[model samples]
Target chain A: MTAHATPDDVKKLAALARLTVSEEELPAFVAEFEAILGYVGQLETLDIAAGSDILPYANTFRTEGTPHEKGVWTPDIVKAFPNREGDALSVKQIIAND
Target chain B: MESNLASLTITEAARKLRAKECTVRELWGACHAAAKTDAVHAYLEVFDADDAAIDAAQARIDAEGENASVLCGIPLAIKDNILIKGKVASAASEMLEHYEATYDATAIKKLRNAGALFLGRTNMDEFALGGSTENSAFGPTTNPHDTDRVAGGTSGGSAAAVAAHTAIASLGSDTGGSVRNPASYCGVVGFKPTYGSISRSGLIAAASSFDQIGPITKTVADAKALFDVLRGTDVLDSSTAPEGSYPEFTHEVKTIGVPRSLLEQGLDPYVVQAFNTALEATGCKIVDIEIPSNKPALAAYYIINFAEVSTNLSRLDGIRYGHAARGETLLDDYLLSRTEGFGKETKRRILLGTFVLSAGYIDAYYRKAVAARSALIREFDEAFKTVDVIATPTMPTPAFKIGEKSDPLSLYLEDVFTVTANLTGMPAISVPMGTVDREGTKLPIGIQFTAPRGADERVFTIAAAVTGEQLY
Candidate 1:
């Protein structure tokens, strides 16, 4: 129930989130992060009653009937892509070779 | 027509338009003049081609005489987060500062059909991350009532614009009290309909479950009119349900419940007094209600908010149409771009979200928060059965001065009274109770009323009663 975030944990989280946290900002992040976690730790003491529905609803995304055909992606929608090749977004290789 | 057109509510403006007391051009001129008259810093950008847009709307009104929508030729400010076709939808972040919306949001599309005129895009907290517009990357929006203080945010600009009479009414997205917080601070009516009441098709998502687009207006009737146009299902957003998807508010609001536990702690005395006066004016019997979930509500709200924001923002890598930073590799590109593009508060949220959702901490934080959220929803549902509505001070206190709450936790506490509605997916509104003097300047405070899910009408009606306005 003692929730605390360490500087290493902060660094790891930032890395996972694809954010570059400078060394100068790391200590501040650690301090604030620990404070927030401690605040949220109060929830650990909550005794959730049995059979209390946790999820708001199941299959909220599913429709009752047949779905309509989606609109075709147009060239205009691709305007945000930094690099494009023949209507496809260009990306660096996901599978790297040695 | 004797009164200033700029100060007229949406209902009054529409009536005047229909009565030929003022032409659409004249109304536009009045609102435009008022917008230029103030230096609230409410707008990030006012469209340069306002005259052209006004002419187009006026032409439609002229051609469709007797058939025009109430919003026809009525100018409105839009929060920078909601998309207007071909307009820059920044979400007040550097990431999308130059990005143009590919298509209109479903709400915008509906409003367009209704012939609403766009005044401009107003500023907001970067990615709608903070409680005050102070976090806006562009700059903070100042409260019109007191120029030195903040307009409550992330809908600060929208609220300020309405309060200043810059726009007849405006739209803002509320994720954990964005709209209502500012509305209370700015002394205007702010409303969030039942979650999924309006489609989120074009809104830049902050926290998906809690995010809802709502209106900021001078009166409840104006909020209702705008809400009417904005609500409906959208094929693009599965979360939105069709009109009448939930049962309507059929019975009159007769009994109001005040959470006794919440009011006993840390509430400003003047705010409490104003709230009591508003409750007494309602003429409904006030009953003490206990919401056990209220204690843990803020903590749970932030946990879930962080988790969802982290996930939602993961889509903003350098490759897509926002601000892009160059790096040698794709990973480096994402890291550098986000680090540069996001503001301090945005980064803080993303990191917090990532930590909560991370493998080791997921169950300890994210899952428990969801369970706590569900408990809060159940508590709200139980309260609604016994009481027609729940009322509280919209914010613990009125608007704070700029830079007053620099620390994060102090700022998070501002949403104490408003987060429950968002968590429960219920309709809630903040109507001006009256003003509480802060150092000789009278700052407006609002009394918030929360109704059961889909009981949007009930909230509006109760608000009307509290404000001494006739129900629309």
Candidate 2:
């Protein structure tokens, strides 16, 4: 797995992570991925059981209850948005025109 | 006068404040003045002492006398990752560099209620990703002992501030050695309480399960003082343990476990010698113990770190808040913002995280790491049955020269000893053992004591014994 990581694999990983790696930086990143993956790959040698639990505890869900007031934080939250109009946050359109 | 005042421990400062020997304004003035001459770049921002907060603390002391909280009027530094309402909680990253925290972190609220003064927000690894704060967007925090060397990080600034006497104490969030690593490098005391002992509601997440807010102070007693104020359950962070979630160790620490195999290689000769000296000084029976899982602990820890960091940081997509970049498409927006906002180390972790959790590879990497985690925890549990505490060199080597470790894996390997406590959700402390010379300069090293989960007090008890300090 360490030697197998290529520039293309890193490009795909960067895309999956929503990060951009420039052409000049791809080789260095791929090299780093190989080195890191090789190091972490040592875990493959461990004789873990077939059905060990990942976490010590089960998933925890907060009890269903009354939510905080709707507009109490709206103004403050809206103030942090990068692009906003009135109280609504704006983003680049995702839908294609027919 | 200011330097001497700045050097006072939290307990000493509190005593002075109570005796009316120094006003809250004077204490803040001493710390603020020291912070202004910070050659190590320990602070991201040294806040102007809030007049109301000062007057309020002074008033409390004047009105309540000895009844006032011991922390009242004591100046402390906060890691940038922890939120303080209306202050910039950047986590030392450009993405959220300008973002102001809308609400106070649970820890901040507790400290405020205790009347602790906020001297500043300290620098750290960007998003707490790197072991050395060289990854900080603002700049690296150099060690106070040696400016050419790094203050071990991602809590580097917090530790450096205390070591330099810029603040009496500071809070640092440790996931894998973040607090203790820096404390070891800077020659101060750092403690990571039992995983859920401290709430994470206001802390910027690095890895969900591993992160625990801890204290960095001049003495073990000071660390204990801050921990007492910070530890507890919080409604906002459900991960916080309820009262008696872990059984208390009622017996005295009579034996210490040494994982001799793990220390046979890679540690500095001086560090090993210092550790041996510190262990003997504990006056506890020493016994050899083997937890083979310790070898793969770093690998497992990093796998989980990448996976969680990738998932946790996904919230910063540039739509609602944080650094934004214009792009033709929505996807393009995310890529551009993240690319421009994050440092190389941060992007590297996020990519590694995505790789491990991606389809087809999840079982091979992420799942395997998870099982390995369980195995490691079980091994620690088994080891603890025979020993009350485990002793090790807090770091493999003392603070390395700045730019010394250019490779990322090298830095990850430095966390070999400290990550085990986080992996097992146990409490650990690093006490300054002694100094080891690096060339003409004498660099400080630390000896770490790890106790069973919920045995946080035991770690402090043993640490105080090793350092010959009275526990608070």
Candidate 3:
């Protein structure tokens, strides 16, 4: 599609990213990012194989497990943080006190 | 002569240090003093442990002489996302506020070994998720040019620090235009090498595939100087492109291409005039061309980026290393920890990324974005086929007000010109073009130069060419 990624797209993207998109934010995202997508989309049909004969992107990242080793928690690394309160780090309560 | 090292590049700094013009300690101290006065919050922590870093650098310079490293004794600010051994890398988030880095990032090791003095860690958007450093849990970094405005972030603090002369070069990670956007805003040189060109180990990555750590400096030459110290394969980032054999930068400037589609955009009128003026001054042929698949660039960026962010951030379970909460059950602990450690923006992105990467909806968002990303790269390859390099306004508009953009998506538009290269994994840079009216104030605008695959050095060459039009 010649059309750019729009706010409806951003909202869908937000939903895909698991973010809660507010109603107030919808219009601005549409206006601002649609223009941005238009700028970026300008490259849609540049023929890359013709010259320098190179592929534009590289897919060589070493995918290692941030190694989510499922196991019980050890205190040594956790101790590095300054405040830990009863099996949890002591921090101010988030959200609101309503 | 007493060393006038503050304004010196890493190259000059090394020469002066070797000539014994001044000791590394003196240089380090001076950088610290200058950085201390910057109220922009460029630095998260300025190490007084300066003596050790200095002594280590001096020992190397004393042994290896000028060969000590490409960055010997040059003071640098690291964006908070990268790890520094024994130092806290907050990534400008409250979660890791008190958490100290367990190891040094591979790039940090390379530069440190080369004798670059660590100035301190700079502020960034919390978890490297936002466009504006405004999302930082700590505070927003004011533009060095105009304090009332933003620094063009997640790397805004790093860019501002370099522009303000607080540090000569700063390391910033560019994922979806974090580095180049801020570089353009702060009127400094921000270069993002091709994806996988620079090592990513030790960086608290926001999106794994797109993140690249590059230099944010005052000039293209400085960026090149730092790049030599930074670009290399590393064991930590086992995923680095197999030592992509690329040539050094060329001094000559010739045929450059500009996409008509990109040129005709929502850019401020003054910026448009300035971009054309800079191109005219380049004395190089301004061959107008078409690069299709460019417009969907930003939407594709948010998609692929947030999709990756969803999967990548899943590691921050508040269990292993990040923020953890105390609760009777594990579920409660996970919920409490995330809510406490993450800022509003980080949480928002995490949610967004997670949703996009989810099972049923994957094809609708993530797949389409990835396909679009490939299409964009193909488009860039095609353009580079015809032209040596591509040029565009680094940003459509100059740096906006601190709170002007309330919706996160609107702020993402600031990356309009820079994200195409990021999406395609092509090398791109933001060089100072000229000033534009920034809400009634004069602000710097950047002209972006992008080169073909493995043409990182070429991007620098073209930037140098553009910069020569009105070299400072």
Candidate 4:
């Protein structure tokens, strides 16, 4: 009763999540993924009729029109970064030049 | 009464402090001596024995006279996931091995103001992922009772510390029974308040929606005292409701709803016998209520857990903080860092999370789980109209041997009885009912009580009754 995740599927997932998986670890991860997915797949058998929302209710704490404020990052916290330049965290460029 | 200072509950310790029968220094000394040992591997780091906090508490007691807070001068163990400013706050993972907290969590700040002294950071499941402390980057914390068994996880160290009398009480974060499960295994009181009852400002996020910082103590009274001190709205946490947001639960508990259907599989006979005996002792009406969503609650809980964990842990990309690895490109940096930093369970969850939340599968897996979750909430709301609390054995079985249940799925199934409360956002507590024997050694199991949202008082009341102690 398992719709198993293939080795290729595992590789794709590892890449998507920015995690490296070695050849030795791939099979174990695949087996675990298959087991977990098959187990959680029981939700598919649950029939929720149409017109019923998945997220039906919000708690009392969820208030509308609450103004949000930007959080300020303290310098001490910024300095904790591995690649810091002049009190700012330095990161490699994300843009691609084709 | 036990003369051993380490064995004193928080209430008793506070009373002793008030009467000047035991100085805070002596209390700290006893707990410190207990903390110094690594026999159970309970502590990741025990703070320096000579701490100024003891002196500070004494000074405050001298000034305030009879007005000191109940937690004043109490030595407590803290889970590694909660941040204590300027101290190393690894979630028992190599990812944050050298990471130091820049500020105290809201809970820690409140405890500090209450004059509670932190003994040290205790070990836990790496990023609170697994049910057993065996996932801890440091070695697993063995059960204090048997020493050959586990002390439950991800709050294993905190529970073990309290059980072993290393600290009068300890604070643990429960995402999915992290606090309660360990509390059951350790034979102590562990409480998980309704979600958002306590501020989550300083806890390292696991499953954001389900995580709560709570207390593990020797008695329900002690747990209640810590919960009172810790529960409140914080501007730092948006999910928290203002103080007194939910009307106080004044309804007396006379009926307990037990979902008989959910107990059909996996529950141990010994635990069932203990639960039945406890139920008889309570003399409260046992109503066999059906929570239809209970069937899928575990599945839904894990789906939500994985999805949230995938998102929450995405921030540990090595550039801003945590252990970093030099690589040719930015992608490589993240991949290499996370690959080396995370444990086996953490990586597996992250992968499954990525799968369920992926493009083609979101609607089928994640969305359906949410619907199941809603169904669960509705069923619970309906059930609470008749019963004030729901009762179950905290775990399906007693504490397994240290290396038992090697399979991840088997480990996840252990959370079956405890995860429903987290899923429905209800308050639950694990109170030690009695011990059940495993082999030749006797292992303790707890009875869990789940109350409606914001009905924390009801949960405590029933729990106090079950434990045969008056709490507050």
Candidate 5:
């Protein structure tokens, strides 16, 4: 497939990434990403093995029990946020609920 | 009389310290002075000679003597992402600028126990996200060889610190090509050990599966020395294999691997010339290389990296322990804190990661990336069956201007030659082959070597033989 990724496409990717992109920077990002993506597009033609040999489940242990992935965080630890002054984090509102 | 301790390698300094040729305080002051004058280093902070602190650290080691790790009393630099109690571990991101660490990273604890003084934190890409130090919120680090070009980064400050003699050696986390890339640009040796070879207890998350603390130093011997101390499992980092000592790590080899396919990529002519010269000079046989879907490794890497980062960084909402989340609702704080605290590139990654991992797109993008990654690794396994190691240009080109490409993808491509090793969980290093760009302003090009999963020792030994020196 001889397909080219457009600036709008790249911008959409950037926005999904949550990066703050000025309108002025869009053309530059598009051109540059297009160059790289175009080059990398060659990957579409190659054949790759289908499955992984890696073990996805890592070893984990807890004081109370042994688990596959240890040290999972709990919401109680989530209470440790410094920015949270009350039940929620406090900051200048980014948008108004019109 | 050479008063600059910065000009000396830790190996040399350790010998001097052992011989009583230089006192710890004297060495510390020399290091302190060196750190201050080396402007290109871009160290996030520097410590005053803590005579008492140095004395205290050295006293225990002195009391322990020969049993102590060799890095004792040596002052060193730490990349910002590694934790050091009371100091901030910012990764040069503004969000964590005010955040202080509550404990030492496991490796830092070991180094401290060995009597190494902390010189302060070095600069890096925001959250270790970009290639050039230009992505640093603090500012880009300049290559000491020629300030005009970049000191290839996210670990630029660490490499620059070693190059400018700001620290005898420095600690950096390599995810993709951070350590080796900068080390090559600065004419130093960068070693990224076998995955899980070293602990990552306190490294701020940057593609967790791939990140590992590596060393950057003037010589391979110095890097080897630091590596000796830094290697081994930490209970704190469960990913590591049980602690095992290296007895035959430095044994030399007569055969080296050179991938014609990898080397023939569109490299700068000078880099191409230098790479071939170094390989030919080694007087060793070159073995062929292979990896399936080899071309896809770079693209797969970025996709996987973005997916991992977005998931990992979702925790940094202004509410919890990072920059405050300031939105009326929980989601608002998460969005604003992430948008504000993260640099442009970091945010771009998080969004891409988030999108790729999102429900509708997960299988098409994220899962596809992982599948491609497995294919690449299998290819590496197959190639190792025929060769002891694989060699390629550490980077596609020499150091580019700091901001020549605003496109994030171009920056990601900088890791192309280096990322495959990261993906396969293999050990690799970059040694300065020679200069490529014009002199005075000449930029250093690097040649990389990779060995099998458990064969990090072989890679180092082979690198030592080919380079014909300690890679200073």
Candidate 6:
């Protein structure tokens, strides 16, 4: 594991997280990240021999229920959309032009 | 006139309403007036009294008489994260600044059925990420007692409203002491019930496994009354525990455990003294106990918190709802919207979460945190075999001056004592212990009591005993 997060590492992580950390904020972000990492790094010393049983999964099933009436929430949902085109949400194009 | 009405506890207010000493509108008026002059800035919006809800509550009280729920006609402040259909539930973040809830949170629905009045949504750390409300996209909620001091948070506004008498009680979600920290700092009672005891449906997601909608109120009984109404299984939230999900806690608290080793350092003298006094007043046997994994519990808690936050917040991609920004490319839209939408602390946590959960680092960080969490839970389970409950100073010190803990690590350290309950999914409550003096001002601190999972009633009983309040 890396000992500390550098400014570059923070910038990369920001990009991955879909956040944009400005160049000016990178140093401070890196410093805070390193501090937090150091703090949580205490867990690295903990022996997990008795604790490795972490994923305790249980299947919970629910009875089928009638769905909400169509269009009941559509207006509110569509209204909250930042950009709407008629009845549908509008977004920037994702397909590449041939 | 309204101030006196505002100051009455929920039980007292209910009794008075029953006796026809005050009208429902009058209580609302009192609280509204308090909110109007509130220097604490607890509420993001102090809604104009819901005339219909007030009328309905009064009609219920008039018809049911003594059979009315104690919360009937009570004015309650809601944390911004809990949805109230047709009302804004921003989680105090800019991303959802104008986002109105399309449906009521399960807790809000329960409270509405009981005829509780919604005063307004209170401020919090944006998306409930920080220990202090200063991280709010709006502004920080100052301690009601001392305007210069911070009301500890992510639930700072909820606690502040209750403490400031702007609301009879409030609901705040606790992931890691979000409710109790503010309650402790503001000198009120904050309770985090067993993780699944209260349905999480409609409450905005933070750390799903750790989050529980809890009550911040003037007294422990008020908290219990609210909790009783809010806790139950829900079809929408599969994580909610069914009735009898865990073994019942039948006996009164007989033995209380003190993790004295953890308390040996970093506690204010006032907090140390108040905790001891509160425990002694309970008249329960106190014994030293050790949970070795607790040493690394905060670290584990934050790791899990970051991971969950990153996952939960991904839903806000600026496509369907909430804040959106235009960018040349689709990927840039997500980045631009998020960067402009979230505050610094939120972005920091998101990055940390991404790092921990990233492919190369997942095993080193995420897996380790999960394992450590399991060990901590097991350790707590072992401790409960011998003790009826555990006690600690809710905060290491009284409310610090606003901006005192600018360093994120220092702020995170304030949560060291409270994160254990969230991590282990145990029930915990912070009752006003007493106050400590700083700069000639008295600041409140709290004594926290934690019980085994599903032993929620046990903590209330002990807390009532300590606070000298009647359990009823």
The most accurate candidate by lDDT is 2
Those runs of model 2 whose alpha carbons end farther than 4 Å from true positions after fitting are A1-3, A58-66
Give one digit per residue, the lDDT tens place, for model 6 in B271-348: 898889888888889999998887888888999999999999999988888899988999989998888999988888
Writing each residue's lDDT as its tens digit, candidate 2 over B338-400 gives 999999999999999999998877887888888888998899999999999999999999999
The local distance difference test score of each candidate is 0.88, 0.91, 0.75, 0.89, 0.76, 0.90
lDDT of 3: 0.75
TM-score (all chains, Cα) for each model? 0.95, 0.98, 0.84, 0.95, 0.88, 0.98
TM-score of chain A of 3: 0.49
Query: Model 3 segments beyond 4 Å from truth?
Result: A1-98, B1-4, B62-64, B244-252, B438-440, B469-472
In candidate 3, residue B138 scores what lDDT? 88
User: Is candidate 2 or 6 superior in lDDT?
Assistant: 2
Give one digit per residue, the lDDT tens place, for model 1 in B133-239.
Answer: 99999989999989899999999999999998888999999999999999999999999988988989999999999999999999898899899898877777888
**Candidate 4, B1-472: lDDT as tens digits:** 2228988999989888888898889999888887886578899999985467899898877678579888989999999999999899999999998999988999999999999999999999999999879999888999998998999999999999999888899999999999999999999999999888898999999998889998999999999999999998877887776666566777478999999988888888989999989987888999999998888889999999999999999999998899999788888898999999999999999999998899888888888888888888889989988998899999999899988888899899899988988888789999999998878888999999999888898888888888898755
Per-residue C-alpha lDDT of model 5 across residues B80-101, encoded as one tens digit per residue? 9999877878889888887777
Error of 5 at B80 (Å): 0.6
Worst 10 residues of 3 chain B by lDDT: B1-10
Q: Given candidate 6, what's the lDDT at residue B31?
A: 87
Predicted structure with the largest DockQ when compared to the true one = 2
Please identify model 4 stretches exceeding 4 Å from their true place.
A50-75, A93-98, B1-3
Q: Residue by residue across A20-39, what tens digits does model 3's lDDT show?
A: 35678667555654554444
* lDDT tens per residue, model 3, B1-472: 2224555666667778888888888888777887888878787778774677778888888888856765777889899989888788888988788777777888888877776778888988988887779988888999988898889888988998888888868999998788988988889889999777788989887888778888998777788888877787765666566764555545455878988777676778888899888888878887988866677767778777766776777666566566666666555666666667777767666655655566755655566667777767777767766688888888888888889998666777767777887777778899999887755677998988888657787788778877773222
DockQ-superior candidate, 2 or 6: 2
Better model by lDDT: candidate 3 vs candidate 6: 6
On lDDT, the stronger of 4 and 6 is 6
- Stretches of candidate 1 off by over 4 Å are A55-73, A93-98, B1-3, B50-53, B63-66
Provide the lDDT at B338 for model 4.
95
In model 4, state the lDDT of residue B430: 97
